[model samples]
Target chain A: MFEGVPLTWFLIVATIMFFIGIYGFLVRKNLITILMSLELILNSVNINFVAFNKLLYPQHMEGMFFTVFVIAVAAAEASVAIAIIINIYRRLINIDVERIDEMKY
Target chain B: MLIMRHELLLVIITVILLLVEIFLPDNRKHTIILPSILLFFIVTVLGFIPGPTGELFGGMYATTPLILTMKNILNLGVLIIFIQSVNWLKKIENKGKIGEYYLILLSTLIGMDYMISSGDFLMFYLGLELATIPLATLAAWERFKEKSAEAGVKLIFTSALSSGILLYGISMIYGTTGSVYFREVMGAFNATPLQVLAFIFFFAGMAFKIAIVPFHLWIADVYEGSPINITSYLSVISKGAAVFILMIILYTVFYKIALLWRDVLYVTSILTMTIGNLFAIRQRNIKRFLAFSSIAQAGFILLGLIGQSQLGMTTVIYFVLVYIFSNLGAFGVAGIISNVTGKESIDDYDGLYRTNPLLSLTMMLALFSLAGIPPVAGFFGKFFLFTAAAQKGLYLLVIIGVLNTIISLYYYLLVVKAMFLNTSDQPIAYFRSDAYSRIGLLMCVAGIVIIGFASPVYEFILSLSHGLY
Candidate 1:
């Protein structure tokens, strides 16, 4: 049982982490850093899932399964993101998010 | 008896395409496109075959009439893409690496197939990721172009962000209902704040996929930078898949909570359309202009969600059917002109009809359909959507929709004016299309023209849309 840590605390921490990721996403100028921010956001969701699974449906283990899937997807997404960033770097020789504004309207 | 007929078909075709590439002689590698197209053409026909429809894999995958028809429609879209892409795909620059294109394209189609047929949250999430990750690579398929790579990065990053938000919402829903299966959650959910919040987050994620107004920042840039073939794929098939699944979840799982989200949709619909039109007017790049126009079209499609009745479903299906042809025809013309002349701006299209009469005329018909002109497929589609909304007594939405149509008309006609009336010193010269591309263009033209006059497609769509309620 989660004797000491309340459910609200877990929810609050996860929410905070999610927003932290968003803040990082907004402020970071490097593609790699922005991707890292995205990872943070996904991880926060995983935390919420795991916590809720433990709190509610401990018998089914649904949330834990979702967490594992999220982890796998995040890995796949990160790899793809890194590949694209590298592709950009190869062409432009810079990975700054600001410089990636070439096609913006 | 695997029961996943459509997904299996997609996979078998993907494997065959990939396998064919390995054995192909270096000089004849591009010939793989022919087999791939032929195979897709077969699948499009096979899609019409009746198959058993029910949940398989312990309720993870479900096939219904709606999903079957949607899958077939998507197959048709992919088939058209193969036709439109062949000549451009076989150019010398695309020589050896052609297999990679079809492989990813087929993989994305498979993902979308599963997404449409998915019966639970786990499958939905998996299918969505499968559909999304390959697209970034496809957007950046022209690796040498800086803009292509940029588009890929933006696409992946934004999709990742949206997926995370969506998962958080899913977690909330799981917490509230203790399940992710549609059937189970539908019974348990009662519009709790947590569940409502979950739906909101989930909607926002899909809205990003559809490139709705607030989350539409990446669309113009992505469309501009991506290869024209992939741009058409994104505008039509990808969007159609998302809309198909979005309506499914909304009408089935979220129906009980409709009152709460209806207002949310109303505000976003108006904002999405107005902003799409306003931004579309100023776009110089034809691809970016279409991007905004598609965004506006997304807003119009959202009107279908307002009613959640069979007529609403009918309108959504019909409109999407028309859009797949209309948008692709326009992009195909743009692709043809740009492939020949390397022109991306509207100014480059001035007096295009003087030389390339076929391309210009097809472009006019497509644009006219998109503007919802009478006697085109698009008009009936929009008419039914408006009728659906009006039946629900949402007259304000219909009125706003009418005004947005006029706003959209101005820009769509601008292209027509530039193509027909405006004259340039040097016009784009007439070009002969390959037989396949001609067939593809003719197919779209046929859809734009013939579908309006024919009631069979409409009736078929209505039959498929049945049983949702």
Candidate 2:
């Protein structure tokens, strides 16, 4: 039971993790790092989902079911993203995001 | 009897394609592809019959006549894409890998089918990921090309970022309303500041897909960087499904907060059109130019969204139908040229009519249709969208829309003049396009010319709607 733990604690922690992931995504120049940040952001959402399930809607398993689906989707996304990153690396011989602008404005 | 008839057919087709990949030799792959294309077309057509609309899986899955019609339109688009890509797909690097292309494409199509027919947020999110991940792979399908790889990188990261933002918003919505079902969400649609913030984030997520002005940074880059078929797929099919789903969600789930969304859409419509047109004028690359043009078209679609009436939605559907034809025709021309001479910029079209009159003519008509010239379906589409907005007393918005059309006309003619009137001693050599591409182009042209004079298609599109307002 999450009796002693306030819902606010989960929400606040989740929000902090979400912003940190966003900050890394925005500022990071490495492709792999950006992807890791993306994973972090998705995981933060998972945390929010699970917390909401435990706190608010334990009767229905919708939130937990959604969290599982999100995890599966994140796995698919990460696999594809990494495959693309590696493909880019083969062409440019580097994974630097700044150098990947071959078709920029 | 299975509830999701089309999805079941799609899955069966996917399995057949995968089996074809396994059993067929590398050289014999092309032979099986045509049959598979025919099979997909047949199954999709057969699946078009109207059935009982039902909600299965406790409102997670849904079926309706409108969803069926939209799915059929998407199938039609994919069939054409198959035709359009055959010539490109037959090249050396892609020959044996044809099955992979169809696999990813069919999987993405399945995702879109799910996205449109979903009754709840969970199904929508899963379907979206299923569609998007493969699309990013397809964007970089040309593995050796640095540009294609760059496009793949850009698409995946942008897509991941948007989905992340969307999930965060969805999480907040769940926390507040304690439900993700549209039926339940509508009941709890209180326009609190927190609710509005969540809605804004949710809209932002969809906006990236629709390529509205603010989140449109990825459009031109990805369009220019990817191969032509993928560009057309992204601009038309993917965006079409996203726009269709966005309309349904706003109309059904967020209908209670109509006033809030209408105001949000009004400013978005005006800004989207003006800025899109302004940026389009400066484009040198043909793909990027069309990218901006599509952004402007998104603005016009948003115009129809704000009218808050069935007539408004009818206008949107009509415009999208016409838009698919017009935009694909333009891209088909670019694809042919890119294949023949590898020229991509607007300047490369100089004196094209002198060398290749047929393609040049097609290009001219397509560009005219895009510019909303009379006797073309695009003119009617835009006319009706503006009228819909005007009927809602958004006169200033209509005026901006018209002005954007005029500005768009100028850039479209820039390519036209270069193709027909400009003289060049060394124009691109005349080259014969493949039979499949020619058929695809012919379909686009026919849709553009005939769908305009004919009134039945518009009426049918209107009839398809059960009533959003």
Candidate 3:
């Protein structure tokens, strides 16, 4: 019922998840791992949306609708992105972003 | 009801085109072009239809004649990109994906159109994400190229970070204002510290898309790595659309805090111009150089925003229109040369005039326009921007803007000199452009020259700004 916990707790949890995703994005070398981190980041966004939908505007479900759309789009994006990553690996045989700096100054 | 019909039409056209692209035979994939052109033409016509500005979906969606105008300009730019890309797409190894590329580009364009019309924070963020993620994929569409992959990674990472920051800002604003509607947020704006912090975060996120100074590192690298056609999309249409939305949001929602944000913009504008031009001067790769040049042009556009007047809005719109043509022309020429030689460096252009006078002349006109030479739209573009800034009593910004213009001229001339003065060791083979690309370049050239002299074009822009408020 979330009776004891304040609404801010949900935001704090979302923020923590968001930061973890950012850390993974910066640290991970594998392309797929970095992509997983991006998913985590997007999930944190969903958490915020759900929390706001419950706490701020209980009468309207617009935030919930937005979260649903975000999830659908993220799934589509991840599928296409993974396919591209696989193609890149087949061509180049690696997914290390650092070594892929062929066009860097 | 009319606006709704217009939006519905665009959505239907986009979905139909996407389906046809997905199912079309590879050899017959050129069929997608007809639908795209038709859709763009329809959207352009719809944009001109007069109607009342109002809200939909419980005030989350808003539309005005000005937003329609912005959407139409973007559609026009996208159509130009499609035409210019056809020849370049034919040369790429995986030519079949050209249809998919157009689809993604159209979908992203739709997102931008919605973003400009969104009246609430939720829709705005969704639109931003939709517009950004596909672009990241487009940057790396060349699966075999390591540079392309790196560009995609960089873009996605930066985009994710900015989205997080922007989300945090939105949360903060909601916490303080208890609402995310633009008008509601405007009513709640005060000198509160939370409001200031939220504004800073919001500015930083939007600044990343606009490629302001501190956030511009990804631009040149991405431009160099991406295919020239996609780079053209990134440089002109994507950035221009973001600036349009930013202008609307800042002017409508955050106008009361203009005094605070204007100071932030002033410092950022000067830094963006100086840094962009300074680095642009040293780049050897034509794409990278133009990347920085585009960043510097963004700073000039920001100068217009600092004016905070109807004149400023009109100037910004006009400059962006001119920029769409000038920048696209430059990239189109670069695309032609790059396709032929697989070379993007200034050195490769030596004796270009001797090899292919027509290509060289187009390149010359593009660069001259970019340098703000007379009889070209870029001159009028910069003139209007500086005039807007001067009206705001921001004379120092205008002076720096002019100095930066001169600095830009030096580098652009360097490319011209290479093409005209130096001789190559081997005779460069004359490259041929397909009918579509040639028509595209001709269209851009015509836009640059004729639009420069056309008073009615300026008048239309003024009328659009008048409708904004």
lDDT of 1 by residue, B179-256 (tens): 988888888989988788899999888888988879999888888889999999999999999999999988888889
Locate the minimum summed-lDDT window of 10 residues in model 2 chain B. B460-469
User: What TM-score against the true chain A does chain A of each candidate get?
Assistant: 0.93, 0.95, 0.91
* TM-score per candidate: 0.98, 0.98, 0.93
Report lDDT (Cα) of residue A41, candidate 3. 78
lDDT of each: 0.89, 0.88, 0.83
Error of 1 at B397 (Å): 0.8
Candidate 1 local lDDT, A6-26, one digit each (tens)? 789999999999999999999
Predicted chain B of candidate 2, TM-score versus the true chain B: 0.97
Q: State residue A100's C-alpha deviation in candidate 2, in Å.
A: 0.9
Tell me the native contact fraction for each prediction: 0.94, 0.86, 0.26
Every model's TM-score on chain B? 0.99, 0.97, 0.96
B241-350: candidate 3 lDDT, tens digit per residue: 89999999889877878899899999999999889999988999999999999998999999989988889998899899999998999899899878877888888889
| TM-score of model 3 (CA atoms) | 0.93
Give the 10-residue window scoring lowest on summed lDDT in candidate 3 chain B.
B1-10
- i-RMSD values for every candidate model: 0.8, 0.7, 2.7
Native contacts recovered by candidate 3, as a share?
A: 0.26
Expressed as tens digits, the lDDT of each residue in B1-469 for candidate 2 is 4568888899999998899799997668878668877888787777777666677888888977777778887887888788888888887778778888899999999999999989999999988988899999999988889999888889999999999998888888888888999889888978778778888889988998888878899989899888998999999999989988999999998887889999999988888999999999999999999999999989989999897777887888788888889888999989989877889999989999998999998888888998899989989999999888999998888888898999999999999999999998789988889898899899889989998999998898888776543
Question: Which of the predicted structures, 1 or 2, would earn the higher DockQ when compared with the native?
Answer: 1
